[model samples]
Target: MIYLLSDLDFSLPLSNPVVVFSLVLFIILFAPILFNKIKVPHIIGLILAGMIVGPYGLNLLLRDSSIVLFGTVGLLYIMFTAGLEIDLEEFRKNRITSLVFGLFTFLLPIGLGSVAVYYVLNFSWPTAILVASMFATHTLLAYPIASKYGINRIRSVTLTIGGTIITDILALLVLAAVIGTTRGDIDATFWVQLAISTLVFGAIIFFVFPLIARWFFKKFEDAVSQYIFVLAMVFLGAFLAELAGLEHIIGAFLAGLALNRFIPHSSALMNRIEFVGNAFFIPFFLISVGMLIDFSVLFKGLGALKVAAVMTVLGVLTKYLAALLTQKTFRLSPLERGMIYGLSTARVGATLAIVLVGYNIIIGETPTGEPIRLLNEDVLNGTIIMILITCTISSFVVERTAQQLALQEENVPRDEGDSNERILISLAYPDTVTELIDFGMMLKPRHSNVPVYALNIISDESDNGKTKTIAKKMMDKAVHHAAATEQTILPLTRFDVNVSNGIIYTLKEQNITDLIIGLHRSANQHNFLGATADSILRHTSETIFIYKSVQPFNTLKRLVVVVTIKAELEPGFAHWFSKLTTIAKEAGLPIDFFATPETIKELQDQQAAQKAEVKISCHAFSNWDDFLIFSREVKKDDLLVIVSSRKDHVSYQPSLEKLPYYLSNYFGSNSFIMLYPQQVERGIKMDDVQFVDGSLAETISDSVAQVSKAGRLWKRLFRKV
Candidate 1:
């Protein structure tokens, strides 16, 4: 039998979604790797890849509806994440500096760009102003690079991020005004309508959206629903912004700001949002941006090339001048100035948006009565080239300058008085993994290189292949949750005959000084500590924190810290106090310290010495009994922290053992933590101390006491009558 062989078709049709999607996915997957191997920025590689597979190149893909849909989503995602990821504390501290930079960056570009476009390129008045505004807008294309280098917390970076909001708003406002004027609607009525709509939109998004979101998040605990709710808010904000005759990006950024406090930077929800954006939406946007380029125009004649060169040079130079002026005024270092310039130079998202808006406006007619486009094809093509060039330069400069800035920071000693400390969270239940990680993050030392440890211990008897696999998967979930907060979690899996022993062994091996474990009810009714947690607490000499969370940590209204007399004299007081302050600051709540006068004085001294930012209010208590009275003052939303000592320690007391029971009875509806501070060992030998198995004796005593109390109360009531 003769076999008929046909030549395989090389062309793929764009009508088939599968074929187009597969090709794009292949490009997205390999482009970065190929570029990385050649020492090129992955962003540039992605854009180039898009061009190669674009309609103008091999004609393999079509610029269909999917591009527009994903492109818009990607643009909004970038803006939303920018607003969400900002260091709010730092932003507040440098608000004035940001305002100054915003004005400088905005004004400088408008002035310089207008002159270049009007005099050099000889564009008309309206056209010149519109194009000038394009130069005024810059995307945070280099921000990820700065964040990667761990210098994102610096004042300069914070200011740059803040300035981005101001400049983009002003630029887009100019675009809106120009569009209105071109459409013959620039009158008193137009101005009034615009102003009123904008104010109403702001009120709805900033005030209404947050209220709804707070209620939604509180009502729903499902992660998938939460993620979808956030997406809905983003699109809703975009839709409202368009309705108000403003850009959708403005709405997206505002939506981020609105929900910023609800979703902590280190939260699992924030992580999921960023992951989805970076992995899919953002890449699609970059590819779509690339497809807009037509390289044939660059080689066809000198006109397009001239326009591109002029736009690129003017854009970079104007942004550089803005940075230089801001640096001089602020007395910043050259490295800082370079970083500011780099971060503010890239023209991409906003630039494209403005150019597209301008390109669509019909301004005047030619001699033949044909409509004369406000932004010509040459200007559009030129802007695309400018985006590619500036993006490349911005990325390179940011990488180099960020490295140098980080090095300078390393050489300079920090005066913040915070020490490097690692926090380890023990995972018991899969459902509570994210909550536990978030707790660790709230207490983690900021701007430090220490990584958080998440330990999952399995008993040796249950350490079969399937059990180990399940444990690994659970640990992976914890890791992903921590990763969202931009935190590094060293996941540890250990096996021992006892779960607590396994955790303790891993802690020692990891050299962890701070341990956090979830609180669980013991099988024995009288035992406050679960068997596993109690064992670890009794055996470990390090600082231990037992957390029982009833609500989200961010919702806490107050942090009531109960400290025993002389508790501040312990070896771990200063360290634990520092961590406490960190949590208070991260929670943005006031701390009420219930301690003796001397202990309060000591804590105050430590706070003043460390220059801590948390606000602490001292409430005097003579002894541990006074803590019982404060239970009435604790609200449902308050977080109670009892600072206790180990058995036989200097600060240890009989009442300390009953503290957990009292809290369980009085503050059952609240979240509470029992922190055992580290103690200094005495000269007594280990064998001299008697270890008692209180499990049996405590159970017997509890039963006998209940029976006696009931009989005595019943006899008294009956006999007296």
Candidate 2:
């Protein structure tokens, strides 16, 4: 062999960070090009390269320690970022989806994985746990894939993210319990201690951290949120992890989450962290895994071959099986189900890290907890073989499968729109509408079933006009808040003669439902804010949510509607109520309705001529005392809505501020949330509404079809991901 760097002995420098760092960079930079051309996985390429230069192959470097430290760092970064992105409120709202998928992904994989390890390969129970845990993780790569498929803003991502977190958490717990048992430390006290510690940590991070960070950012936005401060939080998380005998990665994740409210530059922070981790640190991690691989055992051992094959089948099959559980639960198509199956396939890095740690304890050449089967003379050889086989094979399967899906070569029918809980908000702002901008942001909350849109409508005069600058500033500001749970803001330049007409016209144009605004009374007392704002209230024919300047908006607590046995709601009562209930339930919100005696009787009367067929689990109440009582007990942030269709013109007797006067006073500091109801105008046909992953699927399909006649997954990975 040529002596490029082959003169170095493997035993001499196992922990040589510099050499490991140098080699991984070369491979990572080139792996995509080389692997894509060969139709194999780049991960495999890295592994092959690892074996060639490792102690087992050329003996160029020593194998005293492991490359997993590099992987651990990357894993920590990934986990922390994952935590930062998780929508907690949505998890509460869509707990059914989260709990189901989360549990499915957890159990399905372990069961299948154990069968592969024990039933097929006949490993010990401890080893089975290790194998099973690997299957439990879904790929973080799914984020990129979901983004590529244009479903990132939908419920699909929400379920996937929530499920993945639970999967990893359970995997860790299982690993802990198993490892404890393997090490003779298994006890009820140990499990109890573990549970208590996790709960305490989670509570502090969830409730306390958000409050503190919110306070810090509010009080000292600039001074308290420096880079040094970020570092301190990171250290705090990692140090706590150490003290608590938990993985430092958990600390990193929790730390990022706690500080999400405080970090005004979240996207920028992500970009910077990604730049360092991906461009600089991560390559070293990959290369280190590669450099220590053992080619001899990888090539020679049929046992290793069998394990890889067995695992591949189990891993893919388990996820597919998990997908099946949801088939009856939700009326999703097979393709949608399959897409989720593929989407949830988390990669092997984290799994490998934890397993290897356990493996080192009981016995192993590689990272499985049992007596070492491939150790002694060919330890490194065996390790390299497994890595090369597993990474390459799994990567190839996922990529090719996804590519086929993108191509439409598969016989599956295509669907329209994203039906999931994710929402994208495009906000429209007036030139001087700064008062309720914050309140406006609340209407387009990150945690809502529908994320609000902050759109500024421009006349599109100058390409570099003031509208463009303002729109960008507003978008940047909303993104900076981290308050948008499922929210996305897209601001653009469009022209209109008067701002209000422009606003109404634009509202109709964008396919968005909610319009959040601060109803500022005119200084001149002209009786209205904007003729269009006033007109929008009356004739807009859409749901208009009004925000305010007097109070900061809180998450909507109670949703109340006043109902009458009107002819408009005759046929569509159940359907309309069903829609409202789903939205509220999905948001984990409560809803209340005030009805007349006839209306309450109407709600209960099956023979009543219901128009919309709106089904609801909650009953209607006719008592005035009960309505007042409910209103009295309403949370300060509760939204009391009257389903009025026509816009409210100024009342001569009562001032604009005084309309819902008595009830508004009872609520104290909270702003009274007002919404002009949506009329069942122009009978809603089935095709009119796009339902699916936050409607992004249809949006993408529509946007693309409009732009071009035809498109497929031609270079789909590149196109989508």
Candidate 3:
């Protein structure tokens, strides 16, 4: 016991690294749980715990280099997550709203806060401006709350995230100009250098980074390696931003934007990103924030108290006024206005960086030889207290507002049709399981409760023991991969006379609505449709997808869909269209639909009715005889979706008979999906399905109604005779 206590001298700001880590881990684990029980947010708990454990409180732990490093990463993670999760379509639609809010948030805070600072604090022009600019900048500390509540895709959140980058950029610019003037480095050369470097940084992040990232993802399939690569890119952006005379947070955010298209929100990579950040780094940063406060300073003098009070009031007021003005300008709801205010009110990250820079710059000395800094100690302490208050307020407001928004959204009913969708994926090859599951997920609705069915059908003639073992292994791999993305899949293994019979029987038994099967490698030379695929297509009418992937879905540049004329008349047209749009949205890829003018009009009408937010480029091309005419336009990386039909379907054309040959000969190297929509006769009927306990009451009712109708027809015939 003495040996164990030997390392514990009860020293202030504990020096033992192992002890420090253990204490922090424990705090992280329990602080949030305890705080949540009392109706307080976990964010506040971590922060308040930091205050207790930090040098300013009980001095149980020091805010050392490791703490600062992790804290910085946490800040960057917050910004990065914000950029990654933004609904790009919403952002694009309200780009002007974001810009307007950005301008208002920045100008109001600086314009109003500067005057107040200059007069109330008796600060000079430069010092006042530098201090005021800090108010203009806000960290996205409360963004995680919005993300947690699944409101990140909402328009108000998108606008806040977009406006965050804008305000941070403007605030950093003011900091540079003020610092440059104070250093007597304000010149044309300075302005030119800043502009040129910023442009270069933007180019690298937007252009060069994505190219490299796409290549990296295509080259490597390991989830861990992919996650590491993302982190490296994030830091690279941060380093480049520093080189460009900007804050690292801006670079981190830009990196997220650049990589957003490649990393789907529902992908495993995204799950890992959010999990790691929220679990450890973000909490550490929140705690470090709490450690920054030294409340004792507020008691030493009335001047410090005055400055703290003024800064706190002005900071909160200015951000509120900006949000209020934006709300009025856009005619947004009160909840939306509160959301914006909560997100933007927190003064951290860039704000802290700016204040520290101000405090470090020495201008002159007093008669007593005390140094007169750009920002004095009183202001710094005041800023720290202000950070605590605003962060607390921000977290509480965002938590409450996000909860309300989530509840409100839940109250709004979703389409009941989507809730009943049951997707089935037939997995045979080990190489395609991950891609198949991911593709299936892309086609699934977010609000759907049905788990995807992954079926592995074994031939009855095969060695049952050996084949079952191999199938189980494959199913395990599928289940594990699906689990990584926070999705659950029900694995089914069935044995029948043949693979096709097994798949067909399972589909019928499971009442599957959609079937996704990987294109078998056995289809060589003459057989474009392998035996199993041909059999399933001929026997079943559910939406079937023969997916032959040559590249990862995330790496695909665009979705090139070849729609047959009158294809919209099929029973599965709406279902297949929804799936295509879902994939496009999930992968952040634009869609190019090649169809006749009439078909294009139908597609346009469907898109409008669904309100699907994806870029759809329509090209009128009715030359079915010349299928290769548009081959040159489709890039090597594009995923071609050929919307085909059954033999006697309304959209089936003679030219479609040679489609497999055309695809094999011309676009052989390209990744493609041969989609066969459900035919009219094979459409799912309520009376034909089996429910719980194999009940068939609906089917019995249908049979009785049909017999009654035949009896009425017989009576009418007798009367006529």
Candidate 4:
């Protein structure tokens, strides 16, 4: 049993699981690193590695059951991620364009390919149609490259994903019908049954699954449990799709769509999903694709070579034609056309599924008593080779196109001041840490390099040993939670005489632009602003957000922003506006702004200038006399954002003093934010002041005082409105 390596048999194909696993892991680790030096896309490297080590090459590994299982999961994960990351709003806007592209991609290939397959390959009608259908179908194998480049939100990418689902459905339908015809099951009743089952399956995936996922997420807070629940839902959808006569990928995609709204693109859950799939499952799938290639068939005869060449040419050409037609019809850019073609050209998942189904159907036998299958060995081998070629072209083209697009978009202008914006979250209550971190993340700008800070301040009088241990645990949890979302949270703990002083000190030291703290849970009518929040607000000049949530941010239905008249004049107006709109866009929620006519006009102008994709509806509301009237406009599930102000600020009102008391009494069950925007610092540095124009400076100061006085007068004059 203690045999040495020299004494063991050196097999051509490795059978030991440990050896096979080590070889695959090594391939996964080094293939990308090795290929990066040569400037080749790592996706190509993985596939090539698989081919070199597969049974057809050096025979170091076989495509065993374990490989097949992992590969299948990887394929489904790719489809799921495609759906999960798609912009739902964009998808809706381009549904018609997607349909046009889908029809072109599907019909062009099948129509031309059938003729080529029949005459060039000399296949019969049934077999020819099946083979041609393979040309119409393609997998999203190159999507990971596009995702890595961070261009998934672009219009061209959204259109490709939309078209992908459309064409795949049509392609799978064709496979079902062709198989039915071959099996003598293509009767009227069979079509009716298929239609009914497909509808039922769609309803279950799109309608029922979301409800389940929503409830499950709200009830369970454990990260591991939530991840496992999501995976279970994905496979359940896949299994049900199979029972309904559709491919598992279709179900996996639909499952993603159903849960899309629940998972924010930048949340911890989305990061985990993408991380696992990209790091492990997706690589496994890519390797298995290369293992399907068989070069020996090409050397055995010319028939297989001819078939492979024809299939590859038709597949690539037809897909290009489809992309070109879509470009012309939609007036898309040349770069976008190239992107579509690259994404739609790869043929692997559905192609293999259809070919295997055809190859397994036996119709007759030769005089030698050999069974004559629907798809011969030559076609099977040709399909495998075609997979290799198309995948290579797809990976290379997508990589180049994605790089170009990312560069082009980077040159476009974005918000200016946000490049330096950093957010700090003060963690006190154990239950509010996750929501606080999530809120901070949503408020931060996308693709920002600034790190989020989570702080826990321990009282100096408390026993250092026990208190420090507790604070350390809390900080560690905060860091781990943020890391799941691919974000780095700097965890800090300090001993201070006052809790608010600790937060204020950290804010100044870190140059934090925004401070987010949870509203006190035990505050009564007399103790409303909570000692800590009040103290921090009175001491700091940065933007401060006091939040309390009765439900998860993702589960909220809408964001209702109550803008005070002149609130837009605050120093931090643009910063807070940008944050709210970003949250709306990421959560895929519409926003309703209740403000005075002047404020509404200003908001509309800002929204148009930013060209934000959020659905915004502005309503005229200047009812300062009774702030409670606005409470009727808010639903229990809505996120209410009351734009309050400090007493020294221009937007401050007498009615705002009573806002906390009113909210606790009337809207106690709803999630709300008391947002206080940054005000101008009061102290002016004497060194920076100049006496170049004494009269001019004095006149400007007098004019500012007059404006402040006039603003108060206007508020009084229109108090009843």
Candidate 5:
């Protein structure tokens, strides 16, 4: 081992595959940490490290097959992840804006680029067109920065992402045309073939792949198998795209879209995919891009420098012009326009692909009968330099603009109405405490001052002290989880003979305006809200939310709210609506409101009157039975919310009791919440008596006698079982 260690020297060119792999891994692991300390973008650091070890610099590493393999994987991973992370609902809403930006960004750059290349560089028409197409393609290099700052859901960001898809596809198509024309294959048949093949490719990826994935996911329960299946789909999409005469990135992106609804962002499968890509594949691709840059060429003469400067200036200027036009047309703010420009300026994947394709094409012959290259070595090197410059500028600009946008949003007051709302989550199981806390945070108004309470109730059994200690540990875990999001949770522990009584005591003591409790399953396969959640729902006038999450809250793509008839008449309707809207905004999902015609009209009137921030689409449903049809459409990544009422209330119906049963049978794997809105007071009459079984009967019987003696005593005083 010592002899082998002595023989291994990384300073020199390392041919052993194992040694090369180790050295690259070391660079990947440490570059980000070292660069982060100095406040430099980790991506830039990875690129710089790649340049250092590349054949052009220290000659310690060469661009071998391994680099090519990993680099390609990284490129696909980047596109796939982009599709996976995009807000589809937002994308659909901003499709027109995306199309406008796409056309402007593509046309402006190509027109400007071709004219400049042809007139200034004196290149031929074919060569000029090919070179111009390079400027029309860009990579979302600064997307991570926007995402990190939590501004990814902003309209500008979504528009930019949507435009990226359009422009990249268009640019790559132009590349194909240019390549075919140069290769002397530009005939009617060529166009027809390309068109037909692209359609076929889209059908397979968008329609067929989803069908297969749905069946596979339904049948397969193993986590590892699901992950491998997703990976397979990505590769299959890429391969199919190549067959259709399009770039593989297009296929990978389509694959991501195909699988988006099936795999929730908060699922373990998605976490695994992102982890592998960010940890290894993406960094490798960035490094590979950096390895293409030959600094020596820039120092050689003014010609290369001139080309690099011209390309970089033209790229940035054209993107800026496009963004300016878009901003004016859409009446967007200056900061939003800047963000659009910054996100759309960086040239990488498609740019490199176009340049390389152009470089390989032979358009003419020199005087000596040698093939004349469409892209010369100087042009290639200059393009690489432009890539480095644009990427750096794009990252810096995006970071600054995103931060500004975030700060501006923070300062702007949201019109959620004034209310000191507090949500208390009753913890029964330690495993679900963190998830429950996250759900509460999602429902809470952004930047609000209201505190979140996490309560753990210990039963007054023989092992009370030991249970309290365990409860404290669980509460601490929940507190730690909340702290990560910069949220403070008030932890409360109580001992009572009945768990439900303890929860009710804390709810009253803390004056909680809202209650969140977990939903479990009973032996009969029905959703068991437990005696605790049931008692609170029946007795408390405060709004109550019962949540059962099968996956992470962030994974939700849509918030489906089922509003019963006359739901609008409830006193706490506005409060629960505000909470629902807050969850939608925080989760970056649109709200699909299913309600009766009357209720829908009322809701629309109220929304128009109050200028709410949430995007809602209303669907009419006659009654609760419509939920079965709706459930069929609810994907795995959706959050199902049912707004209910207490017994004998105007909106209360017998059918509401069957909702939990339906949800359990159909959507057991999906996350759902049931809310019971607060009601107005009606004088209680001793003559109007209703029988309820279990703990509710005992508590209510005690409450009736106490109520006769003392007018409306607190419900907790009757809990002496």
Candidate 6:
């Protein structure tokens, strides 16, 4: 009888499960840290460390079953997270191509792989099925890499990704069929049952789950925020799989579909879950895999190498060829096709799980004392070897090819727009509004030189005249406070608008490119921050920006631009920086443009919104004012914007000092100050600008006069209508 270690030993406790678990988990967790220095993939280090201390090599220790549990859970979490991250919207954007490429990718590989495995490799049907699965898989890792080069959304990246997903779906389906065939219990009679079950499962998960999960999330349960719902569904899915005699993964995948919409910030949740997996589960799982590796199976190492080579070559060729077929359908290029091939080659993780299922099915029914079968033995070693080689090759190829395929940043047209109008923006105490204002001005059309109206509404508590006086006072204070801190102002606009409707009404009435906002933003009044934030989050259609402050503004030298070329320029974004250039002529601060890699890559595509930000950024202030409003994104900046007009635009909180949305809700006036270029360039001194010298009360009276005139005109227009 085997006895557990009776006592503790001072010797290096390589045999201790706890020590083994701790060391291995940490090694896996920290593996990627070193890659920061060398610019290498963390995955490389992860696999290496897994093999080193694994049972076969050093056998440093054994992980407790609990840690092993973590690994299993990690696998499920990884799949779920993968499902969540899939850009369904993006997929829809290129649906025709996605479908065509997806189907083509699937068909080409299966056809090629099936023939290669059956005829060339002389494998049986089951064996061919297994082999084809590996060849017909893809991963999305290349998507991010493509993004690094600023080209992920280009036609090439889109086609490749679309094709890759198609291939992956095909692989999963084939994997399911193979597993079913290998299971002796699932005879032909079971085929009808399987088909029915699949249909039922998909319908319930896709059509029904959204309705149910939405209700559950409305309760605002904090625990559910951590995705206890997902966990519960996963557990139920596993249970149902056992009850229904189906693969647990199928159930998990279905549950993923069910929970997709309910999960908030799934990427954030995924990060935490992936951390748990990385630190413990996946490492142990990989290590356990290493422990199972045996070198004694073949004396002729050349045979093993030959097998590895065949598998590797087959894997690469089938995937690339499949992707190319997809490209043919979707019109992808050579580089994108190569990337799809590399991504599809990431089958080891998923493929291995399927393999393990097969192994268990073949071996589970045997006596506990019975030895593993020859097929299991041969397949295990071969599969492992193939996977190891495939993974390494795939990673290298993906990284290299993706790197070689750079994102083509597009030419930002010099500001060309309809009219040169400055803008006025207002906001409350320092927050995301600053980013909005900065970006608004940066991406605004330079022709009209849209000026921002930074308006701050102050309630002389001495007068409670409005119907919603308390709400108005609170909102006004919030806006005033943000601008009082100088978070967003007119330097980003050609003009400023601080009339009526507070900031919120002003924003709603006019076209604003982007609205940067903060939630739970506090005010001196009975601040229902949560309600205010939630209300804004739910009701607003503008591209709302929300950010946690990470850096402080020092010098306003650098500016970032994010304007979707297709988006109509809001009044704030309508004014090009030509007015600012006029202002800059006085201030003498040079403006430079910076765009994220995503933006850089988007330039190549003939898409319009992608061009707006860049064009807005690269143009002269005077010429940009006429450009139509498109979407707006945030950038970092230091200079105060000088815009041309703030007639209708509202809230200019561009500095990072205040929340953009907060100012829009409260201080509609103090959001931005108007400085018209027509006045400044035509010998109107800085002091001559009315806003430069006016007190808040004086400005409000003037604003009230303008508001009264506008109200009368609106009435006249309404009557005419």
Leading candidate by lDDT: 3
TM-score per candidate: 0.79, 0.58, 0.93, 0.89, 0.81, 0.56
Cα RMSD (Å) between model 1 and the true structure? 10.3
Candidates sorted by lDDT, best first? 3, 4, 5, 1, 2, 6
Q: What's the distance in Å from true for residue 550, model 5? A: 8.5
What is the full ranking by TM-score, best candidate first?
Answer: 3, 4, 5, 1, 2, 6
Model 6 regions more than 4 Å off: 1-18, 33-39, 63-68, 99-105, 119-122, 138-189, 221-227, 230-305, 360-376, 402-721
Candidate 6's residue-wise lDDT over 1-721, tens digit each?
1235556543542756666556765876676687545766655556556666655556554444654565556545544544443444444567687677677656765777777767765667776766666666654433334444544435555555556545565676676677666655567667678678767766766766655565554444353365566576676765665455554544555576456434422123433444554456555554544444445544545555555556667776766666667667657667667776676665554566656765665434356667553135455566667666666666677677766665223343434433333344444443354433443343333222344544333333323355234434444444443343333343211122321224445455555534444333453234423443444433443333332232322123233332222111222222233333322322123443332233233322322532322222443122233221211322233332222222212222222222234334433322122222111111322122233234342322233224422234334333432
Least accurate 10 contiguous residues by lDDT in model 5: 706-715
The sequence of per-residue lDDT tens digits that candidate 1 reaches over residues 243-302 is 997778888888887777677655778778878987788788778877777888899788
lDDT of 4: 0.85
- Tell me the tens digit of each residue's lDDT in model 4 across 323-385: 999999999999999899999999888899988988998998999999999888989999999
Query: Candidate 3, which segments miss by more than 4 Å at Cα?
Result: 1-10, 683-721
lDDT of 5: 0.80
Over the stretch 484-577, how does candidate 2's per-residue lDDT look in tens digits?
A: 3223444444566655666776666766555665554441233334454676654454556554433222234455655532312323344334
On residues 1-721, what C-alpha lDDT tens digit does candidate 5 reach at each position?
9988888665566787888898899999999899878877887888888888898878888898899899989989988887777766677778899999999999999999999989988888877877888888888877767866767767898898788878888888888787777787789998899899999999999889877876776567576797788888999999998899888888888898778766644345666787788888889998888788788998998888888888888998999999999999999999999999999999998999888888887778889998878888778988999999888888778978988999998887655544567788888888788778878877776557777888888887538877877898899988877765667889888888878888878877887888888885451235366666777766677888988887656445688888987677666777788788777765667889989887788778767756556689999886676668866878887888989887766567788888767876888778888899875443332224434455455433334433322213323332332
Measured over all alpha carbons after superposition, the RMSD of each candidate to the real structure, in angstroms, is: 10.3, 13.0, 6.6, 5.0, 7.6, 14.8
Q: Model 3, range 1-721, lDDT digits (tens) per residue?
A: 9898875766777887887999999999999999999988899899999999999999998999999999999999998888888777778899999999999999998999899999998989988888889888898899999999989889888898888889989999999899889989899999999999999999999999989988998899998899999999999999999999999999999999999989998899999999999999899999999899899998899888998998889899999999999999999999999999999999889989998988999988999999988889998999999999999999999999999999998898776767767899999888789889999988886655766999998898788898888899889998998899999999998878999999999888988888999988866547888888888887898899889988888888899999986676565777798889988888989999999887788789889978889999999988788898757877888999999987755567788887877887788788999999875445433245422334533332233323322234334333533
Relative to the unseen true structure, what is the C-alpha lDDT of residue 425 in candidate 4, on a scale of 0 to 100?
A: 91
lDDT of each: 0.79, 0.52, 0.87, 0.85, 0.80, 0.47
Worst 10 residues of 3 by lDDT: 700-709
State the weakest 10-residue window (summed lDDT) of model 4: 696-705
Record all residue pairs in model 5 with backbone atoms less than 3 Å apart, i.e. clashing: none
